[model samples]
Target chain A: MRIFFYSVQSEWLKTKNSIASWLCLVGGFFIPLLYLIADIKNKTFINSAGTEIWQTHFTRLWMNMSGFLLPMGLILASSLITQVEFKNNSWKQVHVTPQKYSTIFFAKLAVLLGMTLKFFLFFNIGVIIAGTVPCLIFDHSFPKENIPWLYFIEKNARYFIACLPIIALQYLLSLQFKNFVIAVGVGLAGLIGTFIAFRWQYIYLSPFSYTNPFAERSGFSENILLYATIYFVVFTIISFYLYVNKKIKG
Target chain B: MEYCVQTTDLAYTFSNRQQVLDNVSIHVPEQCIYGFLGPNGAGKTTTLKLILGLLRNHQGTIKIFNKPIAGHRVEIMRSVGSLIESPSVYGHLSAKDNLRIFQKVYQCPQGRIDEVLSMTGLANTGTKKAAQFSLGMKQRLGIAIALLHHPALLILDEPTNGLDPNGMVEIREFLKLLNREHGTTILISSHLLTEIDRLATHIGLINKGRILFEGTAEQLKKEKNRETYILYKTSDNQAAAALFARQNIKPALLPDTIKIAATSKENVAGLNRLLVHNGLDVYEITTEKNDLETIFMNLITD
Candidate 1:
């Protein structure tokens, strides 16, 4: 436990100057801000379905982010974290420490997990802040009374859970390759694959589509979580194995 | 001598089936500087990485501080420090922050951050990111990170590589200080004979993934003597030759010189005085210098 804390702390030090972390945070803010501006523009031009604008807007926000930006952001975040190690040639340095190689791997894994969680935080909170502002500025209903808090939490939970396969796959890819482009390339390719899978009505089967808002009806499907968990477990095992066993070139 | 590091019949081959390290064994004595000398691609860095547990799959045995490295690596590495090849620097982090990363991993004292910075001459590099650091500065920071925990053994692979002359000297002096004051056993590798000559108390000359020679510098010098020749330039080359013959010393006579065997220092000095006594005008006496370069070449070629 002590080593784990120290490891995270140490990993944090490695990233203090990295631009990737800031980009993830900015991505969180950027998504909502875009949604807010569009919401304002839409309210001004079109008047209709006045029952619950917040739901439509919130769902839109979730769709774009969970579907496209969040997964992409997670991939970039994992790449950035590993980039600090490989780009700097710190792999040999970190592995040489007295700590166990497995311990070191898990330590890095923890930091990546923290990054994933942090991304989710920014995305979720940005939605609220961005969602609330339009209501205040345009005199639209806040939708606070009808907002299902449990459902909201469940939706975010399901989205995070469903995003597991992608988080694991990208994290594993990032750890395996020293060249940043390969991981990023694989991720971008995976993003495209998700869209193609969407038309086949099997997008939920694709880890990339779990957080995809277009596939929201199937987001909480048991098979989606089960598949996500399976990929998460499998890829995570492969990542740990590679990290602990692969002969790192100095 | 107490060996701080020991490896026996150690070998490694890459996935491509190219042998990176042959059957190799190296013993680094406690508190002594063991220079691992080899040319580029000779597997010096690979060997060090194996010893440091940066890579695991290998054939044979490696023991650190008398403990087998296979299972006891974590415990053994607690007393070991290493810097392999290029300096490991996060270009975005400051020198202080870079040190902090290692300091935290080793669970070193909080004050170690400042202490290592000052020690490595990076104390004033406040918030200056490592990307802005020169190669020399980056190397120093690497050394500082390695030294922060004050390990009993330090394995450095060409630590002074790419440093200016002054920077190299500073690092050489620093390693000497570490050995002298802190009783740190050092195993440093370099292809530069001059650099190793300056700091190494013991040398393991490796070529093509095998140690060609391993011993003290004096032993290498003795190896040097066998192939050395003494050359003498004189006014009376024929007279010097005749005189050398008379004294039962063979002389190779050239147009302007008489070259005699200088098998030993005492013998050379005695022969010079004898030639002077024999009325041979010995204008110049020169002995061939069999320095490390010649010896290293001989070892590799042979």
Candidate 2:
């Protein structure tokens, strides 16, 4: 337990020095700011298109950022965390220490998860700031009736929960490849491939499609969750296994 | 006498079908500086990894402080500090903070952080991030981390690979202090023969994954003297040759010099005086002793 906390703290210190964290936070804010400007210019036309248009637009933006942008951020963060060890030749140093494999593994995992949460915070802050400008300029009543605070929380919660599996996948891929570009490339391919596969009528079978926060389902069916759950568990197991059993060869 | 580390018939082969270590055995005595000497691709690093339990699927048993390393890995690891190749420092953290993290990992006293920092000469660099450190400073920080827990043994692989002469001296002195004061047994690997010759009490010379020689520095020096040669420069080289012939020395003459094998240092002076007394102007007499380079060359050639 002490070692675990130490690993997490050390990883957190490393995360603060990373460029990916800054890029994700800044990029997330920039994208929402552009969307707000477009919304303000077409406010009159958008209001005439009814409340469903606003819902669809908001949902689509949130889904696109959560499913694509957020995962990309984590992919970069995960790659940086793992690649630092390889580039600096620190794995051999750490492996011979008293710290156990599980401690180091989870410490890195905590950093990845923490980075993901920070991205969400930055995304929501951007949304709130962007929403404020239109709310005052267009004399909009804040859309409280159509989009309740509880609904906002529910949507964000689901988006965050759905990211857990991707986080695990990215961690595994990053640990497997000591190169940043290769890990990020494989992550981008997996994200784009799954997104394209979900466009077919067999979307129910696709794990990426289930990432839809607004989908009208209480709980996932055993089959759909099984696909993701199996992958999540397997990747996590293999990541830890390889880490513990890996030979320290330069 | 307790053995800090012992390996029996250890072997490892990489996935690319390259045999890195073949039937290598090492014995590191407690409170001694055991130098692992080898050329590049000689499996020095591979042997260290196998002893540290970093690599599995080996053919032999490794016992650290007399306990098998397989089941008691964590217990054994806690009492060992290692700098395998480079310092495993988080470049972003301050030098002090890096030590603090390892302090927590090993659950050692906080005061040891300062102790190790001062030991490594990083005490004045407090609050300075490790990223700004030079390669030698980074190596010191690595040694600091290894010393944090006050382990019974410290393992270092090529610890002086990239240091300047001053930095090398600092690390060498620091290791000596650790061994003399703290009684920390050390197992260090290096390809530099002179450095190992100066610091090591016992050496294991490895070549092609096999230990070519394992003994004390004195023993190696003795082995070197057995193959010593005497170079004699004389005015009457032919007369000196006849003198050696009369004495049944069988000297080989080349130009103005005669070469003769001498088993002891006393024999070189004896032969020089004999040549000078025999109507020969002995200008110079030099004895060439075998060194690591010669030993390594002989091992490889044979």
Candidate 3:
């Protein structure tokens, strides 16, 4: 366990100056900053609809985010973070370390998950800033209801869960292929294919279709999260098998 | 003798069914500088990779510290540090940052980072990203990381490939110091005979997916000295040859020189005196012995 923790820490350090780090900070802030600008310019806070204003703010944020940016951000972030080893030609070094192959595999996957969570943290903070800044700028009467903290947290957690299959699949692709374009290309094509088949009766078969349904609160089975969980587990198992049994890692 | 690293009949074939190593076995004695010498594509790097557990599914077993490497790889690797083929370095990180990452992984003392940096002559490279470093500097940084944990066995494959002569000398000296003072066993590989000849106490020479020689450097020297000859440049080559012929010594005549297989140092001296007594100007009488390069060629061709 100590070795595993150390592996995770070391893996995190490799993310320094990588494109994944930039994508996290920028991906998190881009939507909120755009919303803040639009809201401050339009002065929508002056005609607030009580508690619904908070719901409206979060809904719009998730709508724009979950439909496109969230899945794409995960694909790019996971690939970039995983590719750090390949790009630096340091996979041989990583493999030669005293850690178990399982530890190395999971430690990197954990770091990628942590990066996603950091992206969420930054994006949520941005959401708050976007929500409050317009009211502050125009000095309009603030919304008359308390923030729905529990509701927003629940939605964010669910959306994060929904995006897991994408992360796992992309992680697998990046680990198997040294070329960045192939990993990113396969992920983008999968997401685009999900979008094209979104209206199918059995669209729930695809994990990528979950985030949009969960965000819009429509077009999904009640077992949607369960299906996402199953896909995440299946992909993760396949990834673990490939990584540990890999004959030539470095 | 207790060996630090032992491989028995280790063989490997690539995915394409191209065999890279064949029945290659090497024994690196504890606390000795074991040089792995071979030409390019001589399976040197492949053998090193197999020993390090970077390449798996081989036909033989590797034992480090007398324990099988299959089940105890991580435990064995804790005491082993390696730099295989090229220097494995993260280009964007500074030397200090790079070492710090490995330090956390190895869970070694933070002070050891500075220790290895200065040891590899990279302590002055503060805040300079490794990507901007010269090739030699990056190679040094790679070596520093390998040495960071103070492992008992250091496996380096062509560690001197990119270094300037001065850098190479420093690394050679540092490796020697590491082995002598710390009792660390080293298995260094190189294609150049002179490179290994200066440093190796023991050598394992490989070529064409096979090990041709494995023994002490002195034993390799004996093999090189098997065929010794003498060359003579005189004021009169014909006169020197005529003198040798008269003395019942067959000399191979060349352009302005006479060559003969040397039987003993005393006989060479006697021949020189005979030339001088015969009123011939023996401008040069040079005894020649085969070097490791020639020995390597002979081994390969054989």
Please report the candidate that would top lDDT against the real structure: 3
Question: Residue A102 CA error for candidate 1 (Å)?
Answer: 2.1
lDDT digits (tens) for residues A1-250 of candidate 3:
9888999999899888778998999999999999888887877762374557777888878789888898999999989987888887899998889999899989999999899899999998998889888888888766676778998889888888888999999999999999999999998988899888787778788868887744245556577778889999999999999988889967
lDDT of 1 by residue, B1-302 (tens): 66899998889888888888888899898889999998899889888988987766899789899888888877887788888999998899888888888888898897988987887788999988899999989999899988989899999999997799988998899899989999999999999999999899999988888877788878888877777778888778888788779889999886777767666778777877887987777788887668888788767877
Ranked candidates (TM-score, high to low) = 3, 1, 2
- Model 3 TM-score on a 0 to 1 scale: 0.91
Which candidate order results from sorting by lDDT in descending order? Answer: 3, 1, 2
Per-prediction count of colliding residue pairs? 0, 0, 0
Q: What DockQ does candidate 2 score?
A: 0.52
Model 2: residue A225 alpha-carbon error in angstroms: 5.5
Candidate achieving higher TM-score, 1 or 3: 3
CA deviation > 4 Å runs, candidate 1: A39-56, A135-149, A201-203, A218-222, B231-286
Q: What is the TM-score of chain A in candidate 1?
A: 0.86
lDDT of 2 by residue, B1-302 (tens): 67899999998998788888888888889999999998888999889988888788889889999999988888899899898877788787788888876776777888998888888888899778898999899988998888888888999999987789988998998888889998999999999888888899989999899988888888977887677778788998888888988987988897878888864667777777887777788898877548866776666555
Tens digits of per-residue lDDT for model 1 on A24-116? Answer: 689878888886688687764112326565455567677777767788888888788888888889888887787886777778777877777
**Listed models, DockQ each:** 0.66, 0.52, 0.70
Measured by DockQ, the strongest candidate is 3
Q: What local distance difference test score does each model get?
A: 0.81, 0.77, 0.88
